[model samples]
Target: MAANLFVIEAPGKRQALAQALRAAGVRDVLVLATIGHIGMNPQGFKPLAIDSEYRELAYRLKPDRERIAREIEDAARAAKHIYLASDDDQEGDVIARDVMRWCIPEEDKGKVLRVRLKSLAPSEVRAALAGAAPFEDASAARGDARRIVDRLIGSLSSDEGAVGRVQGSLLLELQSKTPVAGVMTYVAPAADGRGDWTAQLPVFAGAAVPDEIQAIAPLAVGASRQGTLANHVMAHDEILLSASLATERSLAEVSSALQGLYERGQMTYPRGKHCAVTPEAVRRITAIARASGAGFVPGLFTAVREPGGEHSHEAPNPMVIGLSLNRDLGLLPLDEQILVHVARRLIECGVPCEVQAPDPQQLRGLPAAAQGLAWRRRDAKGAVLWREPIKAGYRAWTSEQSLLHFMSKNDLGRPSTIVAHVSKFLNRDLVTQDFDLTKKGRDWSAHVGRLFGHQNLSKIIENYIEEHKKAPSLMVADMIEMCGLNNIPTDQQQDYEYEDFEISTGNFP
Candidate 1:
């Protein structure tokens, strides 16, 4: 007998989700897996196909998906309704679209439904089944646009061809960095006996203090704030950055392991575009921190609510309540274990520091503009009151946390591909494992410097997409010429003779 069909994307989640659904008293549902994507752009440099005046790329299903497609067809025929249970993301929506096109019979198409499974927990799955929504057309369209652009870029900068826009840009950015050097300085509030104060004096900005500033030693110096340091919660990219830097794991491996944890309901969604956490997530994180005997406080993390938009999701967190990072999940690999540690530290960051205001007299010499009014310096007699040495040097590489934080702040790549793209720099030898300099050359450096410096590539791509409205059939060089920005010209092609190229409608001279 045919049963209601539930299609999932990941093979690993199929058994778990099916068991969860059964536990929730759901019956007559046969869950199946697409085992990730089944179709991709056709081979060759042709990313665009012209058909009946419409330009669209052909997506061919892999031979391996034939059996899965057949099984879906058989199940769809018997089922009264088919729920496309896929991950709640753009890529997931595209996968669902493919499954729908390949498997769901046309006559029974009305029976097909789209449901977003945020997690495979029994409650989540049951809730999804009860309140499943229709497939999101906007998401699918966005995915299609991305795929077209990606394929276009890949075709232009194939393995044997010139480096692509992103690669060229990053390389340029790193190569142009002139390593800066300077002296460190420190300052603290100091006042005359009569209690007259001055603004904060200029401290140094280098490794060691100059003899001039160190000569004006302060009478007293103490901590401006007390209690533990409150660092902002770590994001997924930050975790990956740390793990990749510290351990032998690549960004891809670390990200995959983290996502695996999310799919199994051990952690929150691994791929989120923003670092903002919902109130519920904050509460759970607080509870977890407190349970772990870390001092956790509420209202410490100022929730940066995102103005509504597509692809905005909360920071990665634990979905399952009371998940002990140390005891409960000890069996995960060392790298995955680092993810838990990073997550815990992020939660602990919400424990606000207990700050005590300094005495007004001590603030006498301190500048009113100075927020942190404590420092180490020498007194007039040259006695070291206290020395807080400013540590600054060349950081050849970065931890997952720092990299993730920077990228998130700058609105870089999407959660799904941030690590993948970053690892490419390592793989391509643009930078070393320590993030030290490499010999990628000047053109690459200029491209990267321009990209990171001005963040113009996105603008260029956006303009191109808006103007063209679709992927162009032109070669990479042609696309670069039309990108409407001063991209780094290909080294060999820079001196080539110019000629007008024929575009879709007109000649781009």
Candidate 2:
């Protein structure tokens, strides 16, 4: 009997998805993994193989992936139905398109379909296969355009080292912010005797400092402020940021762990841009929270529903509601920790809390303090004093969290690509883990600013693609020429050889 063939990107997901198919009563299905992009431009921009008239580009399968290609072809030849079950992102669309072009026989193309496996749960998998559609040609084109633009930027700015449309802009943005030097710390005793809480104020250099602080001081307490702990459910970037903070792991590590859990069907798609939760998801999560004895105000639980683009999915949430984070999942320690944080965020988003803090009006016009040390109210002899907090509220966000929030607000990158772009800075040794730009990073940022004129070139390219529905090679070429790289000797171009699969801009397959 011919089998139904399903192709996916991550090898680790093969077993889980196969099981899902079985649970869904899907029979005689063969699951295979492409690992990742099967093809890439190994020789840089010089030999990118663009057609002169239509500006179409060609890409070939990587040499090591030839055997996999053969396997896919062989499987396709015998399969009753071929489902390209890749991710729902641009990269995934490109992979599906590539598989269609390189592996599936032309005669069998009629039976080939694209299925977006957002999660490996039985229902989702069954639904995806049932509703399978044609590959997203526009998304694949966007992905290809990004690849070409990034490669062109890299090759043109090779002297700067590791320049990218988004990465370069992000590096410049990071460089613009100044790190705090010191802070003023104030300690307050809890009136009910639970414990003492502290409030801090940023202190800058050149602020006048009093010689002695009062031993005891009275600060005006502001009215109690009540709200939910977290304003909304965790989005992709927020999950990465929160997990990084809770685990003290690098974003790259957190991203990997999240991806691992996602592939295992332990969670929903983790790379979604929007923070919205479906009404059904909200009901499920609320039920789980109640079952776990988590306290949350029903009235305060706002169901966040934001409009999203075609590639967007709901915010990250556990696939199996009420599943134990510890025993049931058999997750690695790091994965468990990350999921725990995610669960906490989900619960807190629905929980209400009140905060009290010292009134800001009373602390206005104080002397500027340093970044590391606290400013205190002391006696004439420089003795420190204790004061109760007149105001209570959430603690200040950490520098890393603030950076992530800034990136999210500025649309610096998509949820799928934000952490990777941020990680690239650290990987290239251009920025410290603290997000401070190194000398090399600063120099690169300067070079990019000079060449690209400080605009968000990535957004420009993205907007162009969204509107024009094609690669902006001509626009990019013009930009490069404006950067004074119009002319180059033929001898300077590097050479390489590979099979070519040409795609036209006017009409794509």
Candidate 3:
């Protein structure tokens, strides 16, 4: 009898899954890999007009007809049972669906099978091949929607200048959903901070840094100076994902933001990425949110970024991967101080952080000390205005470092991550990407972009970044609309609502 043949996309993935399945007592299965799909549709924003029955999404397959023909011939000549086990995301779904079109029997529809597997572990691989569900057309359809969105978005160029790169589509799907629909990100260092990124040990990572300030030191610094955040730590930082924040919150702002959480009773110990929010906290926070007058709440939401149940997985988050414990131990930068703050803020808001809720009078009483720091703001022409913070609560300095990340020509994640993260965004459709600019990000990037001549010659360049700091009035509304956000919290006015704070003029801290 001919060996049953299974074809998957990636060689490594195929090998891993194959070994696991073999270990699970499947002996006759021959796992082969095409590496990837030979056939795919060219990407675009315009949807292929289905028959108006909504049966099919409008999309085009790729230009690789010859390759598709070769794949079909190979599939036909191989084992009697052909399985198309591609990556488990839309791109993979599309690949399987396309491959099936040629190899599967038109009448019985059983000759070819599309298998979905989550990971290469033995049980999952065995379960996947054991004949459960075929490829989901809905998954394929959603894939089509994504491709169309991408095509539309590509003109927007490389998913940049947009907030929530991962949650880009969600803002569209969840226009009228319940309370809040938004995107959040979960970012991690490529690896342990030292010699090899794949290295997972803590000791080497800590010693690799120049300062020898083990990750523990940074966390110590954060915990020690918790005074910086003061009261707002008690107020909610109000965001969901760490991934979307890279562009929005810098290292400084993140550290500054978490201080507010330390003041709030929501987090037990600030900072981590455990995805560890418990059932109790979720329930409690959801109720408080409903009572706080923000309606449209969902029953309970999933913390989507949780990874392997393995206690060893380390990444920056609300409650695990402490900068003190992991990242800062290696040599790092002040920017990491900001990331530390972000981790703390994420932890505080992950479940239900107790906040005093900024009161306008009290906010005014909080020092408005935007003062002396060594930073530069330049026009498109490199004309620089150094903004020295002269007051507390006043912004200390201005620079356009963020523009380097957002405006640069790189899409941050690979095909797999992009699909997974975006899928999460699509499923709930509650969140928008972190497209809305922080007062600093927008000012710095805009100035630096024009100064560096990165902008196309379409509009006149002007540096009015502070105008964005206006009350959550018409301008704020306009910004919210453009960024595609909902669930306007009451504290929206704290930034623009306060004209001047009570801090003595020229106060640095």
Candidate 4:
């Protein structure tokens, strides 16, 4: 019999899963990697045969992808069965469907099965193989919808002489420069009988500043200080990802490294959103913590899964790789240290945190006054003056402990994509690692474009998005109505030119 073929999205995952299958006593398996999406639809000034015309996408594969597809096709022809073991996410589902389309011929399509493998552990892979299911079209449909909409918007924007939505908006924001703003201060009496503390309230240009805020009656607002967040330690997924931008690691390097780790079966699936802790992981990490005696309490914690997340895997954990907490983390390199930090965070999330909920009885006899108040005023140079408010209740810099507690409480971005987005922003020169503003000044062209070139551009796109929801129809009507393509004929000619497609901002096309 021919070997059973297993297709994964990434090469690292392929190697990892292959190892797991072999370890689980599976034989004659040909595991291959698609290396990500093999194809994408056309963008830019492409020929559209109809209004709101959804282009018939011809997916162009790279040379390597073509080779891989051919290999899979040959294997599919000879194999008794095939497994679509892509990532367990929407994008991954789409990739699996696309792979099926390209690699498995009609006759051998029936041999294809989908296995959701969130972790590369041999045991989970074995279990998944036993319970593999048929590929779902609904999952692929969502990805298709996103792709179609993106293409439409991109094509339309290109025709209209502008970049995509965000870049266009950024260009508009670069118009007028404001002068230096002044600061204002105010004092509010403390409820705890302490002296008055100063507060700085933000003021904006052309807005009237209120001289004083009236504290009608002191409402006993319960407040607790979580502590200041640490610069070295990552508290949440976003912060962890942003660390890549600060470090020497490029986005590609980080992605490849993490994927390699996952493939090595040393890490869990890196694409998790919430910092949820499993009982088993917690127990193991607690043991490690106690054994290491890292000067912190190994508090046991119970973490609930965040609602509305992908929910396929737990947050990225170090224990997936059997990381040793007792190992000297300080001696490790930056990358290894990062993994260690992630591991520590995963364990810390479930440890019983001390979040003191305000007691109603504790404030029974406190003085009643406005909890906090500030003053604001307008300056002559279009700058606003702000007075800071000194809050009466517990307020302090956010600490690492409080940061972990907060991450344990809220739903956040996937551990994988957080770093990706952060790195993207950094690469774009949008912000600095030290949280400094890099692009503070405005671009004259963007301002001019926003004012005259595409005044109603944002509104039109918004309408299209809203209408697309009601009916995923072609954007032809929108193109005709908003883009002023009224006279353009929707016929076989395919040569209709948008002669009036000129934005006053410039020929951004």
Taking all chains together, each candidate's TM-score versus the true structure is 0.66, 0.75, 0.36, 0.60
> How do all the candidates rank in terms of TM-score, highest first?
2, 1, 4, 3
Model 4 TM: 0.60
Alpha-carbon lDDT of model 3: 0.34
> Where in model 1 is the C-alpha error above 4 Å?
19-25, 46-54, 121-131, 136-138, 158-161, 175-231, 243-249, 278-283, 298-310, 321-336, 355-412, 431-455, 458-482, 485-509
Model 2 lDDT tens row, 276-342:
7655456666776666666655567675553223565678877667544333222447887777667
In candidate 4, which residue ranges exceed 4 Å CA deviation?
A: 23-25, 48-55, 122-127, 157-162, 165-236, 242-256, 277-280, 283-287, 294-299, 304-311, 319-330, 352-509
Q: What tens-digit string does per-residue lDDT give for candidate 4 at 48-135?
A: 3333343333444454588889988999999988999887766787788888888889899888898877666554566577778887
RMSD for each of the candidates: 10.1, 8.4, 21.5, 11.5
Candidate 1 per-residue lDDT over residues 363-432, each given as its tens digit: 4654443434343322222111111233322233333333344444444456676675565545554444
Positional deviation of 170 in candidate 2, in angstroms? 3.0
Q: Candidate 2 deviates by what RMSD?
A: 8.4
Lowest-scoring 10 consecutive residues by lDDT in candidate 3? 217-226
TM-score of model number 3? 0.36
Candidate 3 on 1-509: residue-level lDDT in tens? 23566666655444455666677676677666555665542232122222222223323334445564455445556556666776555567667776666544454245566766544434345556664455545445434444332322222322223323223322322222222122111111212221111111111111222121112110000011111111222212222223224335443344434433322221222232233443333444444433333221222234432222211111222322224312331254434444444443323333221111112332232223211111111111111111122221111111222211221113222323332343333233232232333443343334334322332211111111112322213333343334333332221111221222232222010
Q: How far is candidate 4 from the true structure (C-alpha RMSD, Å)?
A: 11.5
lDDT of every predicted structure (CA atoms): 0.54, 0.63, 0.34, 0.49
